[model samples]
Target: MNEYQKFREQIDEFMQHHPQSPLDEAHRLYFRGLFYYEPSPAYLVMATVTRFSAREPLVEMETSTGDRRRYRRWGRAHFTIDGEAAALTIYANPYEEDFFLPFRDATSGKETYGAGRYLDSHRPGLRQLGEGEIGIDFNWCYNPYCAYNEGYSCPLPPRENWLAIPIRAGEKVFHSSSR
Candidate 1:
């Protein structure tokens, strides 16, 4: 099978069988697969990264479970959907070189998770396109593990990352979160 298919299968397996899966036995019993919006080319974008100043302050982000987490404003990824300009902040772990992105679009409560979604930096969809550009495939976005289990502490998308436009790409809410 193709690499992407293999990767998806692996992720599905992990969700269903891995010890770290957010699902407890009761939830895992009925697990089928994640729901997703039909893949759209409109949301596969190459956004230019605008680095934040070294002195940019670290923001305290609220979490799904009422916890607070701090992340440095590493940079912003700017792109466009249709004719609407969009931008989202990229966060740094302060202790790690890795980057993170959490966002909420117009489709958030109605179509996706209410808590927002995440774009894994190491994923192919968020790959480095060039020196200061990164590919952001909305189809590859996924819900935080907190969506499934309240025990998980997931950072919510800050106001800066909330987009007015509806991004009808990526994973939608799982069976129980349709509300």
Candidate 2:
């Protein structure tokens, strides 16, 4: 198997066997596997991250539990997928080394998790931002823990990251036995 396929398999194994998996014990009994689109080249994008002149106003994104978390609009990643132009807003919290991207596309509430998925650009990925480009593999996007278990509190994707196009990649809506 190729790297992406291997990675997907590893994730599936973790979700099925790991104690910290989002799937609850009862749900794990019936867990088949996560749904995913075929690994499409169109969804693997290289983006140019253009930093903001200054940090944008802090937005308090509400969580699944009705609590809120503060995040600042750090920058934007501009790229194209399947000849369609698109962009995603990056958010950062104070004292964080990695940047967070919570986004929702047309697939939300249907094929994917309704609240949205998250991507984290780690320190190495952040370093590329200074170089004007960062790899954005939508194949790595994953549903929040709240999708599998209600006990989790996940931040909702801000309005800015909602895309009009369907992103047919990454984790799909979890069809748990409990749900």
Candidate 3:
């Protein structure tokens, strides 16, 4: 199989037993407004991430939940968007064994949500990708459950993940959250 195909297979395998698979649930479509530095057409990216690491093999990690969940590490990754190549860095929580992407692009406090947003990379199968070189796709970027719920202490994005450019992707800022 090709690289993307391989990646898809890994993602599918991960969702099978992941804590937030949403399996058997009805599909819900939410509209997210993404803005680019300049006026550029928006592209459709999967907008997700998977976990990876040798010490912690399962993409899943322990969280506030009684059971464990999945997460992705922030490492080195390469992507080509609209034929332009970009490199990114991600972060990992050793204690929680969670991988998260907390980023603040030019959109901070502007077109998109401010205080940065996050993506959960908790796919066990895809976790392997991060174990090595550790570069990943920003397409899966998402908002922590805290964006919608008030009882969770989702890890906030670190200052290092903040990018100077406009991400124009993923979930928007939760206007109600103190973050």
Candidate 4:
């Protein structure tokens, strides 16, 4: 198998042991729709971010309720997508000091979740790889803090993070027939 395949295998094994991850029960259920710890066809994207930034904290994401809520944007970074080059952002907000991402794309509401998917990009995994680089494995992209349950504030994806192309990489929308 190739290197990417090997990495995916490791991820699958990890997921089985840590299913639902560090997220709550609801969040874990939401993530299960997008990923599982088993061998199957998975999308492994190797992309780089062109423009990157790290916000001190305090970011916002508009909600379906028509409210603009602010959350901590501690672990923010920008990168490219499939060599196309884009600025990807991540929110460092885990259950207990975690990082997250909530974004929208052209496919939002149509192809994928209207609010976009969530990615748990913890720092330790890539620290050994070096700086200004990240591997946004769609297999890991699930839903944001809000998708699972209520009362939790989440950092929405900025307008810039919206991808015009359909990722078709990670978990698809829960209610969509396409999924």
The predictions' CA RMSDs to the true structure, in order, are 2.3, 2.7, 10.1, 6.8
As a whole number from 0 to 100, the lDDT of residue 94 in candidate 4 is: 24
Residue 13, candidate 2: alpha-carbon lDDT = 89
Worst window of 10 by summed lDDT in candidate 4: 123-132
TM-score of each: 0.91, 0.88, 0.45, 0.54
Residues 1-179, candidate 3, lDDT per residue (tens digit)?
65434554454454344456433222112212222222222523222233235454434433333345544454544445555555444556556646555566776677655545655557321243423444344444555554444456555454445566566654445443122
Candidate order (TM-score): 1, 2, 4, 3
Evaluate model 2: give its lDDT: 0.81
Model 3: CA > 4 A from native:
1-74, 78-88, 95-97, 123-135, 149-151, 173-179
Clashes of 1: 0
In the range 46-100, model 4's lDDT, one tens digit per residue, is 3443332344546566764557766555444454444554555655542344555
* Model 1: residues with Cα > 4 Å off, grouped in runs: 1-4, 177-179
**Candidate No. with top lDDT:** 1
**Cα distance off (Å), candidate 3, residue 96:** 7.2
* Candidate structures ordered by lDDT, highest first: 1, 2, 4, 3
lDDT of model 3 at position 92: 61
Candidate 4 TM-score over all chains jointly: 0.54
